[model samples]
Target: MTTENKGAFYTGIYRNLFKENGYSEDDITAKIENTWNRMFHGDDEMRIYSEVGGDLGYMVDTGNIDVRTEGMSYGMMMAVQLDKKEVFDRLWKWTMKYMYMTEGENAGYFAWSCGLDGSKNAYGPAPDGEEYFALALLFASNRWGDGTEEPFNYSKQAKDLLHTVIHKGEKDDGYPMWNPENKLIKFVANCEFSDPSYHLPHFYELFSLWCYPEDSAFWKEAAHASREYLKIACHPETGLAPEYAHYDGTPNHIRGFGHFFSDSYRVAANIGLDYEWFRGSEWEIENANKIQAFFSDKEPEDYRRYTIAGEPFEEKSLHPTGLLATNAMASLAADGPHAKENVELFWNTPLRSGERRYYDNCLYLFALLALSGNFKIWFPKEK
Candidate 1:
C-alpha cells in the first residue's frame, strides 16, 4: 500500500480504538446498572420500563419500545463481548421477562414501547424492534447455547412476528406503520419514514436460515420492497435521505433534523450486493458509491455540519449527523476506490463518545457491530 493507504489504514484502526476507549469502566458499569434498574425497579405504575429521554435523547421510547430494546440488547451484547458474563446474564433476564413479551392485540409479538413503570404504553409492533430483537436473541442463543432458554424463545418470537408482517403485508402507504389497538399494521406515523432499515435485509437472511426453502421468496420480496423505497428516498445530489418520505418516495413535508445519519447507513448496508433489487441492474452499486463519495468528499468538515446555500446547517443534534457518517463508513458496502478510506474515517471518528440521544446510541451500537462484523447472527468465527 502507498503512504496514503497506510495512513488511511491506521486511521480506520484509530477510529475503532476511539470508539472502544469512549466506554470507560465507569461508563459501561453505569449503563449496565441503569439498564438493570429501569428494567426491574424504575417504574411500576406503567408496567413498562421508562427510558431516560423518551423520544429525543439516550433513552428514547418509540411507541414500539425498540429504542429501549436495542439499548438493553446492545449493552448486554457488549458485556458479553467483554466477557462480563454476570452483567450479560442480568440484562438477559430483565429483557426476557419484561421487555420480550407483548400484551393486547400484539400479544405474543413484542411491543414497541412500555411505560416507565414497565407497563405497555404503546401496544403496537414495528419491524425495527422485531429485527433488532431477532439479531440479539440469535446472538444470545449462540453465545449461551443449551445452557439458556431465553434466547431460544426470543428468537422464535422475533421470527414469528416477522412472518406475520410478510404474510399479512401489514403496512399502509408503502410503509409498515403501527396498529396499536390490534397490533396490526396501521398508518400512525409518517408514511415514508426509514425506520424499517432496522431489519429489512436481516429479515431475508433470517428467513433463509430458518424458514422452509419454499417460503424464502416472501422474505426476498420484502427486502426488495425496502430497497426500492430507499432508492426513492435518497436525494440524488446530496445523497442524504429524509426521515420521512412520500409513499412514492418523494421527500415528505417533515424534514427531520435535515442531515444524514445512521439510519441511512443502516439502509445502505442492508441494501448491499443486492443491487438488482432496486433498478433491476447494478445501479445499487453505483448508488452506494454515490452515497460513499458524497460522504467522503465532505467528511470531517461537512459531516454533521449541513448548509443550505450560504447559511450554516442550523440543525444541531436532532440525529447526531456525524454518527451516520461513521455508520456509513462502517456499514455501507465498499464500491469506490476510496471505499476503505471512507469506512476508516467513519469507524475512527470519536464523535460517538459524546453524550447521545436514544437512537444515536442504538445506531452507534449498530455501527460498531457492523464494523466488527458482529451484527450478523450466522457470521463465521474469525480465524
Candidate 2:
C-alpha cells in the first residue's frame, strides 16, 4: 500500500474524497466553515471554546464541566489546520498558563484536566494530549513562523516537549510516555497498557522527520511499531479494537476498558489518516473496510458497547455522533462496498447537541476536514 505517487506525504496531493463521490465543493466548504463558527463562536451550549480575558482560551469538556488537555490540544490542531492562528495561540497560552506541570515527576507535561477556573483536577498527564500538542505546535511553527517569546517559540516548545516525552525517565525523575523497548505509547505516562486510539503512526511519521536529530530513529521505529501493533489490536473480522490493550494487543480488562466503546471509536479514524498520509500498510485498507462493513447496516441511535468479537452490550453509546464520524473518516482508506454509504450517511447526520457535544463535534469537524482534503501536513518552508 506504500504508493510512491499517491500518498499526500509523497506527492503533496491530498485527495478530496467528497468531491470524488459527488458532494459539491461549495457545500463542503460551507459546511466546514459553518461548523467551525458554530463550535468556536456559537452560543454557550454550542461552543466548546472560551476566550479568557485577553489572550488565554480553552475548550470545555461540556459533559464533565472541566477543561481537558485532550480538548485543548485538539482545539489547537483544529485551529492550526484552519489557519486560525489567533485561536491556536490563545489555546496554547491557556494550556501553558494553567495545565503545564512545573515541579513534579510529570514536569514538562500538561496536567490532564483542570477546572474552568484553571484549578488542576488531575496532576498526571495523558500521552494522547502530549502527542497531539507536540504535532500541533510543530505544524504551527511551520505554517506561521515562530515568535521570539517563550511558548510562542513554537518549534522549540514542541521539540522540548518531545524530548521530555522520549527521555523523561533517564535519570529516574519520571516515566517516558512511550515504552522504550516496544516503542508503543502508553495510555498514560505511568501505565503499562496502550490505547489503540493513541497509536497514530501518521503523526509519528512526521515526528521522525521533525523531532530532534538524536531522537529521529526512535520515532521512525515507533511509526512502524504502531502500524504493526494495530494489526494485532484490531479484530480480524470486525476490526473492533478494545479501548485499552496490553503491549501484545490483548484486551487489558482494567476498569472494563477491554470492550469497544467511546475511546475505541478513534481507532478507525487514526487508521484512515495514517493510510491517507503515508500509505505504509495495506492492512489499513482491509481493516477500514471491515470496520465500515460491521456498522454499515447498524443505526447510530442503536450504537452500544461491544466486545471486540462483535457482541453487543446493553449499554448505549454516549457519543453516537462521534462513532458515525469516525466510521465515515475510515472511508479515506476503505474502498469496499460500505465506504461510500458510510460517508453519505455522515454527511446527512446533524451535529450532536447538548451536554456531550464537545467530543462528538470535535470528531465531526475532523472527519469533514479529512474527507474534504483540508486536514493536512504543514511541511516547513525551504530556506
Candidate 3:
C-alpha cells in the first residue's frame, strides 16, 4: 500500500472513534494497541512515527522533547478521555519512569528528551513541553480527585515542575532561556520563534488554576512579560514569526527551521485563550488567518511546493497538506467558512505513509487530535 493509503487507513480509524456509531471498546483497544506496538513500544522511546521507523534524532530545543512528549502526553490524555484505565496506567507509568523533574542548572525543572534508555540527550527548555506536562498533571489530578493517591501524587509533582520553569526558567527579558544553571539564565537565540511560545502563557494559566495567590501573581507577571516580548519579536507586515529572536525582541536570521509548523499559531492562540492579554489573542487570530490565506491561495497540487514568504520550509510536503496547518486554520475561524475545508484537508491528506519524521508527525497528530476535540483519544479515558 502507498504511504498515503496507510495514512488514510489510520485516519479512518481515528474518525471511527468519534463517529455517531462510535468505536466499540474492542475497536478502540485494537487501534491503541496498533499505534503503541508500531510506534510507542519501539526503541525510539515515545518518538513520532515516520516511514523510516521512529525518528529519535530530532530534538526540539535544549530540554524540550517535542516529539516524544507530545506523543506520550497525547496518548495518555486519550487513554484518560476514553476511560481506558489500563492503557492510561501503563503509558503513565512508562512516561514517569523515563521523564524526570529535578533541580538542574535552571531552577530545577523537568529535563526534556531523554533517550529511550532514559538518558538525558537534550538541554534546552521549551514552554510548550512544560505546559503540556502541567495540563496532563491537572487532568490527572482532576480525574483522580484530591484524595486519590496514585495519579494525583504524580500530578502534583508535574505541577511543581511547571512552576519551577515559570519562576526560574525565564530570563529578565521576559522570554524563557534555554536553561537556568548556577543561578544564571542561559538564553538560546533560536527559541524566539512562535513554536515554543505556546507554553509561555500556560505558565500563568496553570498558575492561576493551581498556584497559591502569592505564587500566582508572580506567574501572571511572567506570562504578561512573555507576551510583550512576543509582540515585539513578531513581524508586523507579513505576520511572520521567526525561529529565534534576540533578548531585545528582534527576529533571528534563521526563518524556516522551527518557524514553519502550525504550533507557531497554536502558541499564539493558546496564549490568547489562556490570558486576558488582548494583543496575544489578536495576534494569534491574525497569524492563524494569515497562514490559511497563504495556503488557500495555492492549489493542493501546488501546496506541497509552496513556501512560507517565499522561503523554502522544511517538510513542506508533510506539513501544509497535513493536519497541523488544517487544524491551526480551523482553530482561528472555528465556525468560519474555511473550517470544513481545512479540517477535511487535514483528515484526508496522504502525508502519513512516507518515511516517518518522528517530531513533525507527532506535532501533526497532536494538532489533529486537538482540532477534533478528541483529546481523550491521545490520553487515558475515564473507566
Candidate 4:
C-alpha cells in the first residue's frame, strides 16, 4: 500500500512520530536518553566510547579496532544535541591532541584514522569527517559559548577548518578537499573523484551562514553544486548512487568503490535531514520515495551490494544495521506508505551488538534522533 506523495517536503516542520504515534512524552524522552547512555557508556562489549587519562575520549571502530574522524565528529554531534558538553569536549580534546596535524600538506586536516592509543593509522583526511566536524563544532559553539581554551573555541576552530577545506592546495603541499574546478567535495584532498555520501548540501547550506564570511559564498555554491551532483550521480529510477564518483557523476572504479554500498547509505539519510532542515527542494521527496520503495521489500540478511541501476551482486551488506538506519531516516521526506513502516521497523530494531557495533549503533541512534525530531539545529540564545 504505497501512498504516493504529492509534495511532503513542502511542509517546513518535521514530524515527531514518537509523540504522534502514541508513545508517552516520558517514554520518548526516556528512550532517547537511555539509548545514548547505553551506547556511549554501557558494558564494554556494547559501548563504542572510551575515556582517556583526564582529557581525551574516543569512539573506537570496534570492527576495525581503530578510531576514525567519522566517529569522533559524530560523537560530538550526538553530544551537542543531547547537551552533553563534557563528552563533547573530551572528544574534541582527543581530536586536537592526536588527529590534528601541525605542518605539511594536510596540516589543518585531522588524520582520517588512528589507533585507539591516538596514533595515526592514516595521514590523509576524509572530507566527510571534516564536514561533520565543522557542523558539530559550530553547533557546540552555539549551544555553549567558547570556553577560554585553544581547541575549545569551537566556532573559531570550525571556521578555520572550513577555511582550509576550501582554500587548501591553493599554494600548499596538498590539493583542496573540494574540486576547485567544480566545487564538489573530493574523495580525498588530491582525488579527482568524490564519494556521493560526502555531499551534504544541507550542512553546506548551514555552513554558508556560519563559516568564515569570505568563504560563505563558496559554501553556498558548493551546496548548489552538490545538490546538482547528486541528481546525476543517483540513478533516475533507483536513487542508488555509487560510493565513489567522478565530478561528472560517473562511478569511480579505481579502488573498487564503483558499487553502491555502505558509504552510499548515508546519502539517503543526508537528503532526508536536508529536506527536513531547509525544505529547499521538492525532488527530495521523490528521491526519498524511490529509495524507500526500492528497498521496502528486502530483508536484512538478504541485503546485497547493488549497482546504481539496481543490479544485485553476491556481496551482502557489511553494515546491515547502518543500512537500515539510513533507510529509516529517509522517512524524513518519504511520502510512500512504506515510510511509516520503515520508521516502525527501525523502532523495533535494537542496537546492533558485537564487533561492527560502532557504525551500526551510530546510525541507529541518529535515525532514532531524526525520526523523533530530536536531531536539530542549535543557535546561540538571544541576548
Query: Largest lDDT belongs to which candidate?
Result: 2
User: Cα lDDT of model 2 overall?
Assistant: 0.93
lDDT of 1 at 21: 31
- Backbone collision count in every prediction? 18, 0, 39, 1
lDDT against the true structure, each candidate: 0.45, 0.93, 0.45, 0.88
Estimated TM-score per prediction? 0.61, 0.98, 0.63, 0.95
lDDT of 4 by residue, 82-177 (tens): 999999999999999999998988999999999988999999999899999999999998889887879999999999999999899787777789
Report how far off residue 274 is in candidate 3 (Å). 5.9
The CA lDDT at 133 in model 3 is 59
Candidate 3 overall Cα lDDT vs. reference? Answer: 0.45
Residue-level lDDT tens digits of model 1 in 219-251: 556555655666666666655564434455554
The true-versus-predicted C-alpha distance at residue 151 of model 2, in Å, is: 0.5
lDDT of 3 by residue, 106-214 (tens): 3343345556555556644445555565666666666654435544465566656655654553533333432322111123323433333443553354555565455
TM-score of 2: 0.98
* lDDT value, residue 168 of candidate 4: 92
lDDT of 2 by residue, 113-171 (tens): 99999999999999999999999999999999899998999999999998899899898
Q: Which ten residues in a row have the lowest lDDT in candidate 2?
A: 1-10
**Angstrom error at residue 244, model 2:** 0.6
